[model samples]
Target: MKILILGIDGYLGWPLALKMGSKGHEVIGIDNLSTRKFSEEVGSDSAFPLPSPSDRVKEAKKILGINIDFYVKDANDMEFLKETIRKHKPDVIVHFAEQRSAPYSMKDYNHAQYTLDNNLGTTLKLIYAVNEIDPSIHILKMGTMGEYGTPSLDIPESPFVEANINNKKDKIIFPRWGGSIYHWSKIFDTDLLLYFNQIFGLTVTDIMQGPVYGTRTTEITEEGLRTRFDFDETWGTVVNRFCVEAVLGLPLTPYGKGGQTRGFISLEDSMEALRTLIENPPKTGEYRLVHQFAEIYSVNKIAEVVKNAAESLGMSTEIKHVDNPRIEAEEHYYNPEIKILPSLGFKPKKNLKDEVKIILEDLIPYKSRLERYKDSIMPKTKWKK
Candidate 1:
């Protein structure tokens, strides 16, 4: 299969490219390196040093013998994107090019607008480009479970729910209540994908994935092949932030009452799930909604797991409660379904403790590097300022 992965320089995108390339798929990658620039603007970076994208590509060929054609261009550029698609004619297009940080999106007006434009704009361009070039190409968009925003009801994997509003029995696209500008943009993308699928008969797969954590996948055999692991307040996921805090011997701070529960997946499992989906493309004009996550855990539980993992390595950190910066429920019902992946032979490779232990060991060697940005590890971006 020919696979074109946008944002291939990013954390998930880089590894996904390696995974596909290793499986003998012809892989094409594109990115503007905005994530690297965003990290610099936030006074932090990948805890481990990352080679340049070109260097990383060369390393993949050198170490893994996988060839990936990469382009350093923005996916929002419709002409360039359409030309590339027409040129490669890839079977599947994995879209990960977007501003993916909730806290960063909530920072300010410029940040919010940038998040909307970059995320939604890129998706709209991709939709039109695919429609113009090849409607049969499967677009696997990276969506977020954060779009649901802690509703009281159990979340289903199906994009639509059977609603009987005022005795009008009909199925409607599931309600989305995004928590931040970033999440709202993803919600917009979901709608765009569905609309395009309906109007232009485009094949789409919207992966409503949870927070992904873990530094090592099977494809990461050397330093240059490593994906980015951010641990700052703005860009870092909660698990990554906790692991970094534990490595630096700083307190593991959980927001508010520390009862915010959400789903999480390891990088390995995430890649596997994606690969499975790509191999099994949906029928023409079908929009497949998949809930991609391994386990459900509260923020407090994640902190505890990280703390225990660190303690096992003779590094100790206390769990501290802080005021929640985001306007979200600290405690809420969160039972999201996961029927698609398992039926497709997907199972979790590692549990939270094991994964955190691996992350701790990986970060122990980079303690000094983590220490340099320890000041930026705490919550500073507020939803209500």
Candidate 2:
């Protein structure tokens, strides 16, 4: 299978390219290096040192013997994107090119506008490019579980919910209540993909993924082949931030009673789930929404697991509950049904503690690097502000 991965230099994108290439798929990538720039703007860097994009690609072929064709171009360039699609004619195009940080999106008006523009503009262009070039190409877009806010009722496994309107039964897409501007952008993307699928007969897969953790994968044989691991307040996952804080001997802070629960997945499992989805493409005009996550954990549970792992490594840290900066539920019922991945041979391999331990050990050698950006570890971006 031929695969085209947008934002291929990103944390998830880089490794997925390697995995696909190793599996003997013809892989091509496009990235604008916006994530690197975003990290710099936030006064933070990857917890570990990352090689330049060209250097990383070179290392991929050198170390793993897997050659990945890469381009440093913006996905918003419709003509260039369409040209690439026409040239490669990939079977699947994995879309990860978007502003992914919730806190960053809430920083200010300009940040919000960028998130809305860059995210939506890129998606719209991709939809058009695929429609004009080849409607049969499967578009695997990366969405978030945060699109479906914490509601009182049980979240359905399918993207649609069965509703009876005045005793008339019908199925419709689940209601989306986004928590931040970034999540709202994703919700809009969901609707756009579904609409395009219906109108243009485009094949699409919208993956509502959870927060991904873990520092490394099995395919990362050398340091240069490593994917980026961020541990700042703005860009980091809770589990990743907690592990870094423990390594730094700082308090593992969980906001507002520390009861916010969401789904979490190891980086390795996330790549596997993506590959499985790519292999199983939906029919034309079909818009499939997949809930991809390995385990469900609360904010407090993540802090606890990281603390335990840190203590085992002789690094002591306390869990501190801080005032929540974001307007979200402190405690809520979260039981998201995940049936698609498992039925397709996806298994949950890494537990929280084990993966947390691996992350702590990985950060041990980069203690100085993490300490340099330790000031940016606490919450500063407020939803209200």
Candidate 3:
């Protein structure tokens, strides 16, 4: 298969590119190297120096002997996107391109606009480009479980159609009450994809992914000791954030009530589910929505795990219930159904101590970076009107 992937420099994008290339697929990656720029602008590069996106391609070529072509381009540029699509004529396009950080999105009005411009603009360009080039090109883009706020009701598989009356039944898309600017942008992407599918015969697979965990992969050593991504407030997810806090002797800053539950996935499991979905795609004129959650964890549960990891490193820890920075319930109901991926044969790895140990072992040398970002710990923005 010929695959064209956008945002190939992100945390998941880099690994996914390597994973697909190792499977004998011809992979072409495109990125503006924005993630690294964001990290640098915020003075928080990965724990270790990551090679430039170009360097990554060069290194992967040397190690795996799979020469993946990479281009530095913005997906929002419709002309470039269309030309690239026409050139590659790819069988699949995996889009990780978007401004993905919720906290970063809420930091200010400028940040919110960046989210809008980057997320919506990119999708619009891709949809139009694909329609102009080939509507049958499979678009496997990342959506977030966060798009649906923690509802008291169970979150079903994506896009639950409703019927009000037999006499008058018009189709309605599923509920998406986003809790942050970032979440709302993803909801917009889903709507856009659905629109294109109905209007232009496009095929889109929207994977509603949870906050993924784990630091190791089949290709990378358990103790690879590279600049594992941060555990800081700006970039880190809950589990990774806690791991860093615990490692650095900072308080595990649990916002609000510690019972806010969220779905989680391992990196290995995410790649496997994506590959499976690619092989078994939806109909060309259809929009298939799949939930990518593996397990659910609350603030308290994640904190406990981080504390345990810290204790294992021979350091006692602390949990600080800071003022709920955002206006979310300190504790809220959460139950999201993720049925498609497992049925496609995705086996999840649980929160094993050894996995946490490997993460700690890799992060041991970056304790100073953790300390440097500690002052930037507070949440600075919101999603509510």
Candidate 4:
């Protein structure tokens, strides 16, 4: 199968490309290096310097000796994106392209506008390009569990069925009202997927994933080692940040009452979920929203876990209650039911002490670069009025 991965340089994208290539798939990767610049502009870069996508290909070819094609193009440009899709004729497209950080999105007006425009613009271009090129090229987009706020009850698997007026029972993909700009962009992304499915009968699999944790995948050895992982406020997941803080002897910055909960996935499990979904595309004209994750943990729980992990590793840590910078619930009922992907043969790997250990190993050398900025760290991206 010909698999095309957009944003091939990101924390997840790079490893995912390697995973697919290792599976003997003909892979073509593309990225504009926007994430590298964005990481620098935001004051938080990767733990180790990551090679450019080209250098990554060189490294992979040198080690794996499997030829992988790469293109440096922006998905926002419809003509370029369309031409690539038409030429590559990718059987599947794993779309991990977008501005990922909530804090980065809320940095300022210019940043906010850039996030909105870049995310939505690229999504629109991809949808149109896929329609024009090949609707069968399944687009598996990543969405956030943050899009589903800490509801005061159990959240059903991606869609909830409702018996409405006149006893009409219809299923609906779970409605998403995101808490931050990063998540809102993902909501708009699902809308694009649904529209394309409606109009052009495109196949889409939007995985509503949670804060993905862990750094290295099985495919990444210490050598052939241009693959990068970030543990910064900009691109870092919550668990990643807490682990870094624990290692640095910083207080676990538990915002608000620390009851806000989100689903979490190990880095290994994330790769498997994507691979499983891509192999099984949604039926034409159908957009499947699977709540993709293993377990849910609250902010306090994460802080506690971090503290424990730190103590076990013989590091001192504390949980300091910071004023919740972002607007969100402190204590809320959050029981999100996510079983679809697991049923599709996705056995989630355990992400407890051992998982934290793996991430700490990757981040130890770059500990000096971890910022202590509490002000610009939390989710604060407001919706456009």
What would the per-residue lDDT of candidate 1 be over residues 1-385, giving only the tens digit for each residue? 9999999998899999999999999999999999999999999999989898789989999999999999999998988999999999999999999989998999999999999989989999999888887888899999999989898899999989998989899999888999999999999999998888889999999999999999999989778899999999999999999999888888999999999999999999999999999998888899999999989999999988888888889996899998888888888999998898888888888778888999988888898988888988999999998
Clashing pairs in 2: none
lDDT accuracy of residue 26 in candidate 3: 90
Where model 3 places Cα greater than 4 Å from the true spot, the runs are 165-170, 222-228, 350-354, 382-385
Q: Model 1's lDDT to the true fold?
A: 0.92
Each prediction's number of clashing residue pairs: 0, 0, 2, 0
Reference-based TM-score of each model: 0.99, 0.99, 0.94, 0.92
Q: Please provide, for model 2 over 1-385, each residue's C-alpha lDDT reduced to its tens digit, 9 standing for 90 to 100.
A: 9999999999999999998898889999999999999999999999878898789878998998988889999988998899999999999999999989999999999999999999999999999999888889999999999999998888877778989999999998888899999999999999999888889989999999999999877798778989999989899989989888999999999999898999999999999999999988877778888999988999998888888888998998999988899999999999888888988888978878788888888899999989999998999999986
Summarize candidate 4's per-residue lDDT along 112-138 as a digit string, tens digits.
799899999988888888887777778
Compared with the true structure, all predictions reach lDDT values of: 0.92, 0.92, 0.79, 0.77
Q: How does residue 219 of candidate 4 score in lDDT?
A: 78
- lDDT, candidate 4, equals 0.77
RMSD of each: 0.9, 0.9, 2.1, 2.6
